[model samples]
Target chain A: MSNTSAPNKDLPGTILAFIFIGVGCLAWWDTFDMGDSDSYVFPRAVIVTLIVCCLLLIGRNIIWGGGKNHKPLDGSAWRRIGLVLAMLGTALLMPVFGFIIVGMVLFGVLIIIAMFEPWTRKLAIAYPLIGATIVISFYLLFAVLLNVTLPTGSLFD
Target chain B: MENPISYFFMSWSDPYLLLMTAAGTFAGVYVGAIPGLSVTMAVSILISFTFSWDTNEALALMVGVYMGGVYGGSRTAILLNIPCAPSAIATAIDGYPLAKRGEAGTAIGVATVMSFIGGLVGILVLAVAAPLVSEFALMFAPRDYLLLAVIGILLVGSLSGESLAKGVFAGALGVIIGMVGLDPLTAEGRFTFDSITMMGGIHYVTAMIGFFGVAEALAQLHHLETPAIKQKLERITPKWSVVKRYIPLSIRTSFIGVFIGALPGTGGDIAALMAYDHAKRSVKDPSRKFGEGAMEGLVAPESANNAAVGGAYIPMLTLGIPGDAVTAVFIGALYIHGLNPGPMLMIETPHLFWFTVGALMLANVFMLIFGLTGVRLFIKLVECPRAILVPLILILSVVGTYAIQNNVVDVYWMLGFGIFGYFLKIYGYQVGPVILGVILGPLMDVSYRRAIISTRESFGDFMLEMVTNPISALLSAALVFLVVSQTPMYKRWTNKRRSV
Candidate 1:
């Protein structure tokens, strides 16, 4: 193995600092269009502070070695990506299918994606039943007991 | 004034009231234990349900839930490394590590006992020192508030994982995000970019739920195949010697909690984090290293967050100003009940004050009983398959997000933040400061502008005022000291001095 660290963090740290500087510039520019000093002062002050912090980060990476490994995204990263996608899917589908129905679909899909266990007949039967119980119980608690109006799908309505 | 004694014992006489308080505590424990279900949300929901109930009955239940919920967040933090509320972030730092070492039960026992002690200290202060504290709080000017916000933001140093600069950058990002909505003073759109949703700004709670809950779930997916840690079931309760050793530290941190919690713009979240920081500095001989299952680490934050409950009520009952978010909801609850929580509230409604004190005490006792009894069951939760737990956490986060305003946009925002936060975490940046920034950003914006306005927008005059005013000068000094203490130069100097 090479003596040097596997991944250099300084590169990413410098990149992030640049991004922060860009954000700070945008924030500072926006303040100029404001009608009054009251609206602009705080943002301007914070922007300056932010820009300074970004510069500090850049300087630190230059002064101190950050050749340490940046987190590697492997199979687990893809799984995380899938989990986020599943959540987004549920968000889009929930208003259409109602929370409970979408909730079950979510549970079913999430378990299949997250669990590496082979699709056994027992799990196939058990997962849906348990998912239904959790979703329905939460529905009752929020809608019935607490009187929170759950999102009723237009189709259901 | 009515006798405080008669009011203190008010709940004891009424079985129904006692039952209601117990029920609230029970519900609060589970609600708080669940990731994404925050105490503020629970209390806010309770306000809607208890609208028709009698005033005393509603107060009892709300107080019970408030007290119990703050303590409950530590449960998930210890068992799952996912804090149910922002206040529990500090708890997860050490509590989760303790759980990994199969000491989940012992950590929880310490948290429970310390929380009870902290709760008592807070209530005691509320009972005896509320009037004095209220008077002191009322003296704070806008400039002082800006200073307080600065102090809070600087505490990001504690949350900085590997790099302090990264923490500051994350916090600044949060501040920028917080500034997305309409300017509080000028009513002009800021960073909105003509987007309707941006005009409303981001809700810190949504950001917090996303960062801590959803982000944590996504991160857990990386280790789906890792087997669960088998928790030690025996010797769950701490011995008297162990308890006694930590009592002094608990009392000290509890004082910090009560003091911070009583501040108008701050709450248990800040209190817990600050207390954790204080513990890191003060506890020279920790049982283990701080942030690695140190008994002191768990005790400091757990005690501080609960103590904040009483600290929060000080301003609400006396001055109408909210001490924290939960108290802000409580103010709404009081208003709904046709009572104004202002200067004359205690004088006019003395019984309410006394009853709350009594109720909070009762709730703390209930929390102790409930908290200690759930270790076995909680360990099972810790030992559950990661594959199963990860999905469940995702769904729970969704449900919790949906509960807030019943809007899908909030859920979307939550998921987005979660993905973003996961990346940030992987990059070795901490998310706690970001959430803290979001919470304090608006406060900072409003206060900074107000202070400048108070000085007629003259920059030199504003600087002069900061120095001329005794309180402002003290606060400015504190901020400078905080910065100086964290510098590498200062650290080296201190070490050299100590060596000499």
Candidate 2:
């Protein structure tokens, strides 16, 4: 219950609280401008409740150092960030380069970053084969079997 | 009308239906094993393709996937401590530990058999009690439905690891996400901020895939180099003695699943959590400590969650209401096929009802057969080096989100939420309540608004009616009790009394 420890552990909680509070405020502001009271009622109620919950979270962390010493964000977490960026990049590139080509590129990049191992002879051969197999299988399953119209990539066309 | 007996055996008689069912179950295992790909995502995608197919064939395959998916989630939970679905959360408590002790095969085999029994229990209840339960379901009003959502939200207590405040914040955030887009009734934007994409609202399935699948993959990165726990392959199936020992426990937990799954806005996730808590409290002494690989711990939740599958279908088939998220998608499939699913559905298309029940029985058998045989192979999957699995999971998440509506924006939302969910998980803030909130938020909003609107939008009148209506009054009382019992004051008072 003491707040004597270093505050590094509660950093995430504090940040989350601030984000929630900000989102709640922005939502409340939008609700006020929506014109129709009927349309805004549910959101208004929910935002008010959300703001209160955010405040409580902030108060708990400040008063009792709650969520302290929890898995503090470390440099290693950047690996995860890299993975997310790669996927996001894939999404952006898929329409331009097609899902298959972009997917394989991102898959290979992500594997290297995630595994922390340089490409070996075995991986060099296996990675492309596996990546190609996965990409094409997804294409066939969605595009051919399910008949979904997947993005063909403007470049490919 | 055709004889009900023939309708029940329709899948057995039709080779195509049988094939679809088996294939669906097989696909479901791998899908459920994968962190990001969900049964809901699979079924939602299937709906697009199956729209042109016969209703029976679509339902047959979907039932297979649904049954297999629920059971499949425990696979990752046991082996990797990453639950593929929210319903498998409790399974990881004991399951992962068992795996650490090289008992992954036995743990999964036990989970599979228990899941089969639970599925059978749920189906039997659905067949025998659908009409009776549906009749009872008809008695619920909008206010009662709102109360049900409230009760469902309160179950976030079970999901919150160590902090109720954090859970509340997470859950409230989910509700806020669910509140985006146009108001359901008025069609006016509430939090869209004038963007076209924002007006469409965030899909809970998208939120779920982000939270459970993508977030989980990121979390796994923290332990990327942690060597895989090698599993013991001997005695994959439990002895008949072990099976007999857990039968009573499975039965009790399955009942819990059926009842919760039958309720609107609740499903296997809630049922499984409740059953796990019950197992912890009821078992005098488990095979191991509850969170330390207890067989009772594994059995209780595995059976209950699968049983809840049957429970979920009851309301979908008998009443018009969806029992859970997947059932909500099932209802959409029904409407797409030009069939109404409600009280009248039983009277008009009884064949559909029997067909669903029969398909469920067949799927359960397939789940058992497939579940038992794949132990050695699945362990290899679990042992697959993290370097390869993590990236593949990320790709699957993106693909699954894209397949949802073929929209790039949803893919963005999925990644954004995935990052957010990762931070929340690391900070000990549960992402489960947030997803639960997204799912139940709309239900709560619509029910609350409709209830008040029916009373002329008078808050006092709504309060008066809540107490006057017998069904609403009962639900209101239960909600009050649930909230009070979860409070610190109540815990202190009970503890003090117990000490004397």
Candidate 3:
């Protein structure tokens, strides 16, 4: 019944969050080279604390395997990966194509990635129309009403 | 008290200010209900548009939005797990669970009523004890704020700590993210990697959207086919018994919100989290466990964060110090209006102070009306199919992140954090503490250094000073008490005492 939670998995995604920490650790090592001692003091202290905590978490995972129902990443991993890729592509291209164009395209890409039901004729027509309406509405709301200047791409200019 | 009574009802008496307050409260609900829009962003934007408007009219509108927005954040937190603002982080812990149990209507109802009570209590305190509270807020040493941040982080240390390591690591990593830009004190970069884009620093709003908004969409991929739970909407207003049960707790957390809000740098987010911690500690017979659909969990934070609205104004009116980002914007608003905010403000123009108090009280009444009525429409959002809702949320998150600064780099950071946060979630860790860490990390960093320098940089002297000073000693004792209470030994001892 728990949403967003893979209700049956016990192997809490330690490997993933840990991978992120590993990346953070690399950047933190550069704190040693800063010219001013005042700048690095708090960060260095936090780095030490983080490293210690990471070790403890890793140790706990090894000694006590999580939920008995622990399973490896399954086929849903593909959808998760695709969701990330579609959004990443949209983000990278937004400045080139602009928010109006990229936003409409991203909505279509996401619907296809997330959809499980077989597409019907009505479904085909409605999805794109609704997506465009939502995108345009938000654009007007942010750009006109809120006074935030949304990106206009080189393509549009 | 010296101000004329009519000044207290100025917004109520004026047709223009009354309409502005009502319109502001209405727009605030939708703004706060949306996934990536923030009250700070809203207020900041309003400043640009209101530059030519009457200052009193502008303040009236903003006061309504501030009160309504803080309460509105709970809408998404309850309906979906995403907290639009940091203030509602605690609300989602139990609120989302309540929605899963098909009680979204009841949860929103509880939050709205409790928020009303909390907002009223906050305004009441602002009226009765603004000066006394402002003076107390000033009395806190830098070390005391540092201690408060530490305790805030440690609250995560106690949450489902089946392994305390993950919780602490997540929070510490968030602190590292908060430190990415130039050092506030020394002007040297902490982790910018010599890149110009990195020097601007990452906004916590982006981090907030990533961790709560996009990450939640990623997690929903596994449940696209799961039918939405139809929420029971019969009882929008809580029963008299339910209201009576929570009144005492509501008042306690409202005071907590006011106290934390009165502090110069802290605001509702910290206040709500602290109040949530207090609820967990005090309520021995909760209807359900704290994170598992307990009504108490929803009530405590809702009240505290809303109460913080009144608390945030105290320093601004009394000492000319802005309490947080939104109030800092208010300070700007005050100046544009040609009214100076300081100790002289009360003596010179008591009418303005009383006018604000009245406008805030009016806003609280508006918040209650709007908050309860909007539940009927907002609950439908949670019921939208995952396949459609997921895509909508993802796009909204992207657009909202872009709107923050019109920068693609911030959008990139938002997506990166979203992917990381997705993994953190499926891994069974709560991202609330990480957001808390991001919000409080710099404050802690600045305060610790100031406290240390105040002791002439002698580690021994710093340690000595904590005990020698009354406030520091009290905070130190509280910190120690929290740590001791978290130990398994303490749990076992308490269990035996209860059984006996």
Quote the lDDT for A34 in model 2: 76
lDDT of 1 at B225: 63
True contacts kept of 2: 0.64
DockQ of every candidate structure: 0.59, 0.58, 0.60
DockQ of 2: 0.58
Positional deviation of B215 in candidate 2, in angstroms? 2.2
> Once model 3 is optimally superposed onto the true structure by TM-score, how far is the C-alpha of residue B459 displaced, in angstroms?
2.1
A61-119 per-residue lDDT for model 1 (tens digits): 77875636764654555676678788999999989889888888888777777786677
TM-score of chain A of each: 0.81, 0.85, 0.79
Candidate 1 per-residue lDDT, tens place, B1-500, comes to 66888888888779998998898898888889875467888898889889999988998899889888998889888987778787888898889899989899999999999999999999999999998987787678888888877777677544445556666677778888788888877779998877787888787768877887888887777666667788888887889999999999999999999988888877887788888888888988999988788999999999999999999899989988999888999889988999988888988888989999999999999899998896798788778776567767777788777876778888999999998888777767788778878888988888887888888888899899899999899989987887777777988999999899
Q: TM-score of model 1 relative to the true fold? A: 0.93
Candidate 3 local lDDT, A1-157, one digit each (tens) = 2334233324454464466568657867779768876677778888878877766655555665442333344447788889899988998898889888999999888888888888999989988888899889989988887778888788879
**What clash count goes with each model?**
0, 0, 1
Q: What is the interface RMSD of each candidate, in Å?
A: 2.0, 1.8, 2.0
lDDT of 2 by residue, B171-286 (tens): 77888898889888889887888899998999776787777668877887877657656678879999999999999999999999998788776778768877886787688878
Winner of 1 and 3 under DockQ:
3
* Model 1: colliding residue pairs: none
